[model samples]
Target: MSAEQDSVFVRNFALVIATLVGVTVLLIVIANSVFGDMDPERQALAEERAEQNLSPDFAVRLSGEPAPAIASADSGADEGGVTEVRSGEQVTQAVCIACHQGNFLNAPGIGDKAAWNERIGKGWETLTQNVADGYGNMPAQGGAASEEEIRAAIEWMVESETGLEVPES
Candidate 1:
């Protein structure tokens, strides 16, 4: 083929490859977004993402070692948030922090804005409402009966995850 024809062919091939790669990445992100929230405890902590990014099946096998602070799951040994509790720190400590602690719930890994953007896209109030009413794997009031407790829990989680100050209105 002529030089110009070769260049055109190469450009088209590059475009096709680039498009395919873009679609693949988008699919990966969407899949991760949809399924990353499955319970990823110390038993399976290396998870798909961690396996893809961190050590290979390392978190799952570290059973004898202490379960490090998880990304966002609470193995609440205290039966956390089962009743009316208004302490922000407590509610958060008891409840939301588990799944909200890190990237466990397709989360932004506590303080990662990029991870929270879409949730924030729904508006903070809406997000708060979801926490109050329960969304997906999360329980209502994050399993707390008290509104204040739930708000507090959400505020703590939001602040920790995004560093954004929640207003009391």
Candidate 2:
């Protein structure tokens, strides 16, 4: 082929390659924005680029499935992934109180001694299971609290109702 023709062919190939690269980048950027940070590839890249020495104690961590955490009565429950140690009262206030406060969805009101008495007699296992599996109009774990958190909230409500303390096992 002639040198001039060869040069023209090279330039055209280069232009095509550059165009393809630019279009690929634009498509990636659009997908990242539309899919948000949940895009696996984008999220992995962001996490890899994030400061390696950053402390989790200062930041909220995200995960697909939360790891199980050991719960203590004095310290409270810690559902893994975020490692937030929430107290029973905190759980109740954040979740249970919404429904239990006024019998919304026929939930037993927090301080309703009579209403609580019958349910409380069913024992901790039954009550906790109910919270975990969902009971009546209440969703499973009500607000999706960990098993320990549900137990704590149940104990807190029982005590508030009848001045009886439920053991945390």
Candidate 3:
């Protein structure tokens, strides 16, 4: 190629290289300034960007079956779920106390931890089940009409005096 043409080509290549280098430096500087230092304005702008990117139904269910009900009358009892029972204390006082005052069936006292130590070792679930279904002299639902009454009696007896954590009904 001619010397003039070669010189022009070399100059064009150098100019292209310089322009690219300038652009790269500018991007790096812009990034460093934007990221390195934080101000309220920048923070606000980023939050705005994030908000714009987010959807109104951000927490919408994307998939999966809706969770099953914990306890419906038709659905039947929940594991460690609240039972439909109340007035347990009254029932216990009226009925259970007669037999339990003597600590029959080896069940614990009202608040005697030593007595309950073995029963508690049997676990809360077993205790609830035993009481609900009837364990020896305890009788089913403490021989009450409704499950609510049974659970209430259990909760009052176990939690109030014994310090057991009873589930809500």
lDDT of every predicted structure (CA atoms): 0.65, 0.77, 0.67
Kindly indicate the candidate among 1 and 2 with the higher lDDT: 2
Pairs that collide, model 3: 84-148, 85-148, 85-149, 86-148, 88-153
RMSD of each: 23.4, 13.7, 18.9
Cα lDDT for residue 153, candidate 3: 62
lDDT of 1: 0.65
The candidate scoring highest on TM-score is 2
TM-score, prediction 1: 0.39
Candidate 2 lDDT, 1-169, residue by residue in tens: 9999999999999999999999999999999897855868878877876755465533554764454454555444454423564677889898889888889989888878888867776678878988999887988874569888888787777785568655433
Please give, for residues 64-98, the per-residue lDDT of candidate 3 as tens digits: 54433465664455544445443768877876666
Q: Which residue pairs collide in model 2, if any? A: none
